[model samples]
Target chain A: MQLPVLNNTPSQAEHGAKGGCSASSCGTTDNQMDSLPDSIREKVQNHPCYSEDAHHYFARMHVAVAPACNIQCHYCNRKYDCANESRPGVVSELLTPDQAVKKTMAVAATIPQMTVLGIAGPGDPLANPERTFETFRRLSEEAPDIKLCVSTNGLALPDAVEELSKHNIDHVTITINTVDPEIGAKIYPWIFWNNKRIKGIKGAKILIEQQQKGLEMLIAKGILVKVNSVMIPGVNDQHLAEVSRVVKSKGAFLHNVMPLIAEAEHGTFYGVMGQRGPTPDELQDLQDSCSGDMNMMRHCRQCRADAVGLLGEDRGDEFTLDKIEEMDIDYQAAMEKRKVIHQAIQEEMDSKRLEKAVKAQQHQQEPKLTTRPVLMAVATSGQGVINVHFGHAKEFLIYEASPEGVRFISHRKADQYCGGDSTCGDGESVLQLTIRALAGCEAVLCSKVGYEPWEMLEAAGIAPNGEHAMEPIEDAVMAVYKEMAAAGKLDEKNEAVRANA
Target chain B: MAVSIIDLCVNCFACEPVCPSHAISEAKPHFMVDPKKCTECEGDFPVFQCASICPIEGAILDSFGVAINPPGSLTGIPPEKMAEAMAELQSH
Candidate 1:
């Protein structure tokens, strides 16, 4: 996969990691593999954590059905925008249920491993029964391979459980910060339901009561439930262990402890109060401390309402929220742009090499010796040839400065070789190319020539005088070539190769 | 597996799901238990799966009406967790 090499400087992971990935700048790459989502919590644990080998992988995309939400939370206000469009946040484009279905199909095609389909935030799915159910209805009808998951504050869950069950949605994640209604109310600014702004404690109590009911409903129905517990320092961090205890007792399968990312500018709770986000370690300790009873989800990205893919995966850098309709175009354009950046990198490396080669040939100034003695191979008949044993990419750099337009003559092309060829034009065998390169040669140098070529060449009796030992193809060839050339022995057979070329 | 529904059953289908084969179903006519698929999670879990999470009492039962474990009894966890893990693996 030629991903965009946004950072040519190369990342530490890329240099030493198994994938040999060259892209280091993309933030998503680091967070490529996330904790299994709550929906697939149990099912995914059954699958291999890695693909055979421990290769980091990306999660499937999730599409948010924004138009619906049952009980409104204080923080949620969905006016769709594909804003910066890295993940699902604000939908840049909204879609009809039919349009969403088609768009998911298109997204699945473009992103090969679109494992789970998701709908979260904007509004609870149960609240906007018309839009949410229709989206789920259409998705199940069209593409069933992609697993289904939904996240809600859990307000309208009870009423919608049967519908979710009918579609066989295997996993469900509900965000429950504090079991306390007082705290819950403080967290949420307002709740709009049945056409009214149920504000403060009133709305909080209603939403919490309803959400808890929803969790109970989901558990009773056998839908695997995962509890997303956000840790708001000084708020619910201390109460988290109790949250774990209660949910675990209720048959909740897992608890995902997430850090509250206070959107300072959003005028949200922490932002208006000028509170900073938890240091990663502080959040992790809280998660670890409260992870017994249930499989704790440590790797949650807390993706925007429109988040898709495995837990914590942002498609690109900026958490994006595209309207379900524009998912296809936005993703494709991002992919294409990533490709263009990749192509540009390869071209740069090649040009850099080409420039160096030209400068070496024109300068012809023998490099001053710094360490051991240096050896240079002159253009013998301008058909400079070097026979190789094992072709490696590093072999080409030796003649990188040779005036001898060195032509590599190989017996068999090796896998992953940088440069070498054996096919002879006019059906002659590399005997011709090697002969051309050996033309006017003082001595033909190689590892071990086969009996036939050896016999024919030794028949000329150009003394085979050169140092020999186990070494790389290029080094060995250069060693023997320079040693033989310095000794200055040649004969009639070498003249024949010159004429052929 | 004739059993009474317990208080803990919010009726979330978490239990009915992992039942090996197709045994547990919806709580209709009092959330009946199908003994056929109720290997008591022996196919996976070592003890009665229902009791593990049955917030209420006696949600799971044998044909003879014995609760998987009386509420006051020691937890199904064997004194040796590793031994239980090993024994469960052997059963499979």
Candidate 2:
């Protein structure tokens, strides 16, 4: 199946020539967003983690106030002094409710784009009810404009839904790995419930029932729910599509299938036992399979519990407890500035949409180009841009370009050739493997390509181009296809020669 | 009989919170279960809480020094099959 076309705009090929949708333009005009009620749309429009479009413009922060979890996940290794770690369940420092509020105010004052405050936790937010609720209570009273979010394991979620709604918590994330108790048994060892520890499939059954019940109850209160499932290679990878389907049927607004991080250094059970995380290709395939059932959030960064700033960045150190204590923040003045800034951003986005509409109209009036479809690969680190370096790319998003427009085919996993150093010891064989991974692609587009890989790609009959660096992947792939067509490379005989080469 | 967490524990902190007896504490290498306070969930839980939540195979032992959650009990993937899967992944 083709990647979901997010926008309501006509296909680029329908515009005849020199017309393709950019990531920002397409994401902003999401058909799904248009279908939602105005209230629901307003809630998600600016949440960086909720709307794939808004992440480019907005920022979110997670306060590590909750440090206790009720359920045991094999992938979790919650410890302290994890300042450099980027995974969930890791935090630099734990904060009290008052300190968390102070830090939030300080961050909001300094960063006007910071509009959402989430309590994702170094542990389950609902598990630490008092600490989590106290932080939310203070934030809701002081900073009423900022969105409040809570993410839970869903074990304690059913019991805490009432308190969540009381605090105006509209966005809730539940990490539901599976609906089947047997598969859940592999991921969660036990859950403490009703003053007792339930183990194996029994505990899983209780957790799943509570999660489904919590999802229904939250939706009844008109709260938006996003289901996050960890894609464990053998454990729950194959089971996640069903989970997505089940959650979507239960009124979940979005599904974020995050890859499990099982690196041995994290000291998790799966890591020590040599359990492998799903490859990028495997993850993309699962997301694609489930996209038909629900709106698949393809831009999740699997943020840390104490994550700060934008989705891909962290600025937690900027607003530490000590730093917050020293600085006096005038929240009233900050709120005024934020309102003006948010209005300006909305105006800019409006103009961008208008510009894209005009371009589409112009292209539609032009004569169509007769070109054959060619598959091209793009190196991107999300945001739908051709931004990743050739050596650093873990996956290449394959796209098909023809007179029909550019369409995302699938993702191809590549063994990274560069290890972030100047060493090139075994780069040759790795590069060969990468090229083999992109067998049918006519060209590979990236931000930058090394001289050796460029030469090798050319020898392999796959043109390598970095000219469209930072451009939208769809636009870049279409431009490359146009270039190939101009060079008569799309001719039947030329195609045969390249294939045989 | 009280349960014990061996050196094989990876410091995952899974067992510390679920202990009904409040017997588990963080130590240098890994978590340790106190014999004095440990009840093994005799009247509280059907299964030992520490052994039930410990992710590593054979990380927690019973009073007789036998693994509560032995290899292949949690994941259900046999040791040989797990090794094969890892080798295949590494080869890729």
lDDT, candidates in the order shown: 0.47, 0.75
- TM-score between model 1 and native: 0.45
lDDT of 2 by residue, A265-295 (tens): 5656687678898765577678766653123
Predicted structure with the largest lDDT when compared to the true one = 2
Off by over 4 Å in 1: A1-42, A46-55, A68-82, A85-89, A293-296, A307-501, B1-92
| DockQ for each numbered candidate | 0.01, 0.15
Q: How does chain B of model 1 score on TM-score?
A: 0.51
- TM-score top scorer: 2
**Interface alpha-carbon RMSD, every candidate:** 23.5, 6.0
- Pairs that collide in candidate 2 are none
Q: What docking grade applies to model 1?
A: incorrect
Model 2, native contacts kept:
0.02
lDDT of 2 at A149: 95
* C-alpha TM-scores of all predictions: 0.45, 0.73
- The segments of candidate 2 whose C-alpha lies over 4 angstroms from its true place after superposition are A1-37, A79-81, A293-296, A357-466, A469-477, A485-501, B1-92
Q: What tens digits encode model 1's per-residue C-alpha lDDT throughout A37-154?
A: 3344336432211111011133454555544443433333232244442322344444556666666666565554445677764445555566667888777766665567787777
